[model samples]
Target: MTETLDPEDAKIITLARSVRARNGSTEGAAVRDETGRTYAASGVDLPSLQLTAVQVAVAMAVTSGAKALEATALVTEADGPAEQDLSVMEDLHNGTLLLAGPDGSLKGRHV
Candidate 1:
Protein backbone atom coordinates (compact mmCIF):
# COMPACT_ATOMS: atom_id res chain seq x y z
CA MET A 1 0.00 0.00 0.00
CA THR A 2 1.09 3.56 -0.60
CA GLU A 3 2.58 5.29 2.44
CA THR A 4 0.48 8.33 1.82
CA LEU A 5 -3.20 8.29 0.89
CA ASP A 6 -5.34 11.10 -0.45
CA PRO A 7 -7.80 12.36 2.15
CA GLU A 8 -10.81 11.60 -0.03
CA ASP A 9 -9.56 8.09 -0.59
CA ALA A 10 -9.11 7.63 3.13
CA LYS A 11 -12.69 8.73 3.68
CA ILE A 12 -13.88 6.06 1.29
CA ILE A 13 -11.94 3.43 3.16
CA THR A 14 -13.59 4.47 6.38
CA LEU A 15 -16.96 4.52 4.72
CA ALA A 16 -16.45 1.06 3.29
CA ARG A 17 -15.39 -0.32 6.65
CA SER A 18 -18.42 1.18 8.30
CA VAL A 19 -20.67 -0.41 5.72
CA ARG A 20 -19.07 -3.79 6.25
CA ALA A 21 -19.42 -3.55 10.02
CA ARG A 22 -22.96 -2.28 9.93
CA ASN A 23 -24.17 -4.90 7.50
CA GLY A 24 -22.08 -7.72 8.96
CA SER A 25 -21.01 -8.57 5.46
CA THR A 26 -17.84 -10.13 4.13
CA GLU A 27 -16.93 -7.10 2.06
CA GLY A 28 -17.77 -3.46 1.58
CA ALA A 29 -16.93 -0.83 -1.00
CA ALA A 30 -17.21 2.88 -1.55
CA VAL A 31 -16.90 4.83 -4.78
CA ARG A 32 -16.59 8.48 -5.54
CA ASP A 33 -18.17 9.94 -8.64
CA GLU A 34 -16.72 12.69 -10.81
CA THR A 35 -18.94 15.15 -9.03
CA GLY A 36 -17.45 14.07 -5.67
CA ARG A 37 -20.54 12.28 -4.44
CA THR A 38 -19.80 9.01 -2.67
CA TYR A 39 -21.70 5.73 -2.43
CA ALA A 40 -21.10 2.80 -0.10
CA ALA A 41 -22.40 -0.76 -0.08
CA SER A 42 -21.85 -4.14 1.46
CA GLY A 43 -21.85 -7.34 -0.53
CA VAL A 44 -25.27 -8.59 -1.64
CA ASP A 45 -25.48 -12.31 -1.03
CA LEU A 46 -29.11 -13.25 -1.28
CA PRO A 47 -29.78 -16.76 -2.45
CA SER A 48 -31.33 -15.62 -5.73
CA LEU A 49 -28.96 -12.70 -6.35
CA GLN A 50 -25.35 -12.17 -5.48
CA LEU A 51 -23.09 -9.18 -6.07
CA THR A 52 -19.85 -7.94 -4.68
CA ALA A 53 -19.75 -4.68 -2.75
CA VAL A 54 -17.92 -2.97 -5.59
CA GLN A 55 -20.50 -4.12 -8.07
CA VAL A 56 -23.33 -2.79 -5.92
CA ALA A 57 -21.57 0.52 -5.39
CA VAL A 58 -20.93 0.90 -9.11
CA ALA A 59 -24.51 0.09 -9.90
CA MET A 60 -25.68 2.67 -7.38
CA ALA A 61 -23.56 5.29 -9.08
CA VAL A 62 -24.85 4.42 -12.52
CA THR A 63 -28.45 4.32 -11.38
CA SER A 64 -28.00 7.73 -9.81
CA GLY A 65 -26.81 9.10 -13.17
CA ALA A 66 -23.14 9.25 -12.36
CA LYS A 67 -21.34 9.04 -15.69
CA ALA A 68 -17.88 8.50 -14.25
CA LEU A 69 -16.06 7.68 -11.07
CA GLU A 70 -13.03 9.32 -9.53
CA ALA A 71 -11.88 6.58 -7.17
CA THR A 72 -12.92 3.47 -5.26
CA ALA A 73 -12.09 1.85 -1.94
CA LEU A 74 -12.82 -1.70 -0.85
CA VAL A 75 -12.56 -3.22 2.60
CA THR A 76 -12.23 -6.97 2.31
CA GLU A 77 -10.42 -9.90 3.84
CA ALA A 78 -9.23 -10.95 0.41
CA ASP A 79 -5.89 -9.67 -0.81
CA GLY A 80 -7.34 -7.72 -3.71
CA PRO A 81 -10.44 -6.99 -5.69
CA ALA A 82 -11.93 -9.69 -7.90
CA GLU A 83 -11.49 -9.39 -11.67
CA GLN A 84 -15.17 -8.62 -12.17
CA ASP A 85 -14.98 -5.77 -9.63
CA LEU A 86 -11.98 -4.28 -11.38
CA SER A 87 -13.79 -4.53 -14.72
CA VAL A 88 -16.70 -2.53 -13.39
CA MET A 89 -14.36 0.25 -12.30
CA GLU A 90 -12.64 0.16 -15.67
CA ASP A 91 -15.96 0.44 -17.47
CA LEU A 92 -16.94 3.61 -15.63
CA HIS A 93 -13.57 5.32 -15.10
CA ASN A 94 -9.88 4.63 -14.84
CA GLY A 95 -9.31 5.47 -11.19
CA THR A 96 -7.40 4.29 -8.19
CA LEU A 97 -8.58 1.20 -6.35
CA LEU A 98 -7.63 0.97 -2.70
CA LEU A 99 -7.74 -2.29 -0.83
CA ALA A 100 -7.94 -2.35 2.92
CA GLY A 101 -7.94 -5.11 5.48
CA PRO A 102 -10.70 -5.73 8.02
CA ASP A 103 -9.00 -3.41 10.45
CA GLY A 104 -9.18 -0.66 7.86
CA SER A 105 -5.46 -0.60 7.22
CA LEU A 106 -4.38 -0.05 3.65
CA LYS A 107 -3.15 -3.33 2.21
CA GLY A 108 -2.60 -2.64 -1.49
CA ARG A 109 -3.57 -0.38 -4.32
CA HIS A 110 -4.22 -0.53 -8.06
CA VAL A 111 -4.27 2.52 -10.25
Candidate 2:
Protein backbone atom coordinates (compact mmCIF):
# COMPACT_ATOMS: atom_id res chain seq x y z
CA MET A 1 0.00 0.00 0.00
CA THR A 2 1.17 3.49 -0.69
CA GLU A 3 2.02 5.32 2.50
CA THR A 4 0.25 8.59 2.25
CA LEU A 5 1.73 11.20 4.52
CA ASP A 6 -0.32 13.31 6.87
CA PRO A 7 -0.88 16.78 5.55
CA GLU A 8 1.28 18.23 8.32
CA ASP A 9 3.93 15.52 8.16
CA ALA A 10 4.25 15.92 4.44
CA LYS A 11 5.43 19.43 5.19
CA ILE A 12 8.29 18.08 7.26
CA ILE A 13 9.66 15.78 4.55
CA THR A 14 12.74 17.20 2.86
CA LEU A 15 12.70 16.78 -0.94
CA ALA A 16 11.05 15.07 -3.88
CA ARG A 17 12.18 11.66 -5.06
CA SER A 18 10.28 11.48 -8.33
CA VAL A 19 6.95 12.09 -10.02
CA ARG A 20 4.98 10.24 -12.70
CA ALA A 21 2.13 11.72 -14.64
CA ARG A 22 -0.48 9.53 -16.33
CA ASN A 23 -2.01 10.30 -19.62
CA GLY A 24 -5.79 10.80 -19.34
CA SER A 25 -5.84 9.79 -15.73
CA THR A 26 -7.01 12.02 -12.90
CA GLU A 27 -4.55 10.53 -10.44
CA GLY A 28 -0.84 11.33 -10.82
CA ALA A 29 2.07 10.06 -8.76
CA ALA A 30 4.93 11.73 -6.86
CA VAL A 31 7.49 10.70 -4.24
CA ARG A 32 9.74 12.94 -2.14
CA ASP A 33 12.67 12.54 0.18
CA GLU A 34 15.90 14.30 1.28
CA THR A 35 17.29 14.40 -2.27
CA GLY A 36 15.34 16.75 -4.56
CA ARG A 37 11.92 17.42 -6.00
CA THR A 38 10.73 15.58 -9.10
CA TYR A 39 7.58 15.77 -11.22
CA ALA A 40 5.93 14.24 -14.31
CA ALA A 41 3.72 16.60 -16.23
CA SER A 42 0.11 15.78 -17.05
CA GLY A 43 -1.08 14.59 -20.44
CA VAL A 44 -4.03 16.89 -20.68
CA ASP A 45 -3.08 19.83 -22.83
CA LEU A 46 -4.69 22.61 -20.88
CA PRO A 47 -4.05 26.30 -21.19
CA SER A 48 -2.20 28.03 -18.42
CA LEU A 49 -5.43 29.37 -16.91
CA GLN A 50 -7.30 26.11 -17.27
CA LEU A 51 -4.33 24.21 -15.93
CA THR A 52 -4.29 26.55 -12.94
CA ALA A 53 -7.98 25.91 -12.42
CA VAL A 54 -7.39 22.16 -12.63
CA GLN A 55 -4.52 22.37 -10.19
CA VAL A 56 -6.66 24.34 -7.74
CA ALA A 57 -9.46 21.88 -8.28
CA VAL A 58 -7.24 18.87 -7.76
CA ALA A 59 -5.73 20.35 -4.60
CA MET A 60 -9.21 20.89 -3.30
CA ALA A 61 -9.98 17.29 -4.10
CA VAL A 62 -6.91 16.05 -2.27
CA THR A 63 -7.51 18.14 0.85
CA SER A 64 -11.13 17.15 0.95
CA GLY A 65 -10.26 13.49 0.46
CA ALA A 66 -13.39 11.86 2.13
CA LYS A 67 -13.55 14.17 5.11
CA ALA A 68 -14.35 17.84 4.64
CA LEU A 69 -16.12 18.59 1.40
CA GLU A 70 -16.83 22.27 1.74
CA ALA A 71 -13.44 23.50 2.84
CA THR A 72 -11.00 24.70 0.20
CA ALA A 73 -7.50 23.25 0.05
CA LEU A 74 -4.40 25.38 0.68
CA VAL A 75 -3.50 27.02 -2.63
CA THR A 76 -0.06 28.28 -1.57
CA GLU A 77 1.48 28.02 -5.02
CA ALA A 78 -1.28 30.13 -6.46
CA ASP A 79 -1.24 32.52 -3.53
CA GLY A 80 2.22 33.77 -4.50
CA PRO A 81 3.67 35.43 -7.55
CA ALA A 82 2.15 34.87 -11.02
CA GLU A 83 -0.30 31.97 -11.24
CA GLN A 84 1.01 29.97 -14.16
CA ASP A 85 -0.56 26.53 -14.29
CA LEU A 86 2.74 24.92 -15.35
CA SER A 87 1.57 21.29 -15.53
CA VAL A 88 1.07 21.20 -11.77
CA MET A 89 -1.90 18.86 -11.77
CA GLU A 90 0.27 15.98 -10.56
CA ASP A 91 1.63 18.04 -7.71
CA LEU A 92 -1.80 19.18 -6.60
CA HIS A 93 -3.01 15.61 -6.91
CA ASN A 94 -0.27 14.76 -4.45
CA GLY A 95 -1.57 17.44 -2.10
CA THR A 96 0.41 19.85 0.10
CA LEU A 97 3.72 18.12 0.61
CA LEU A 98 5.69 21.01 2.13
CA LEU A 99 5.10 24.21 4.01
CA ALA A 100 6.62 27.49 5.06
CA GLY A 101 8.68 27.54 8.23
CA PRO A 102 7.65 29.33 11.40
CA ASP A 103 9.18 32.59 10.21
CA GLY A 104 7.40 32.25 6.83
CA SER A 105 10.30 30.80 4.89
CA LEU A 106 9.09 28.30 2.32
CA LYS A 107 10.65 24.96 3.17
CA GLY A 108 10.09 23.51 -0.29
CA ARG A 109 8.67 24.54 -3.61
CA HIS A 110 5.37 22.82 -4.41
CA VAL A 111 5.94 22.44 -8.14
Q: What digit string (tens of lDDT, one per residue) describes model 2 on residues 1-111?
A: 134545534432221111111243332222222222332222234565334323444343444442212111122222331233333433433333332322223434443
TM, every model: 0.95, 0.23
How many residue pairs collide in each prediction?
0, 3
Clashing pairs in 1: none
True lDDT of residue 28, candidate 1 = 94
lDDT of 1: 0.93
Relative to the true structure, candidate 2 reaches a TM of: 0.23
Candidate 1's residue-wise lDDT over 13-100, tens digit each?
9999999999999999999999999999998888999999999999999999999889999999998899999999999976889999
CA deviation > 4 Å runs, candidate 1? none
lDDT of candidates 1 onward, in order: 0.93, 0.31
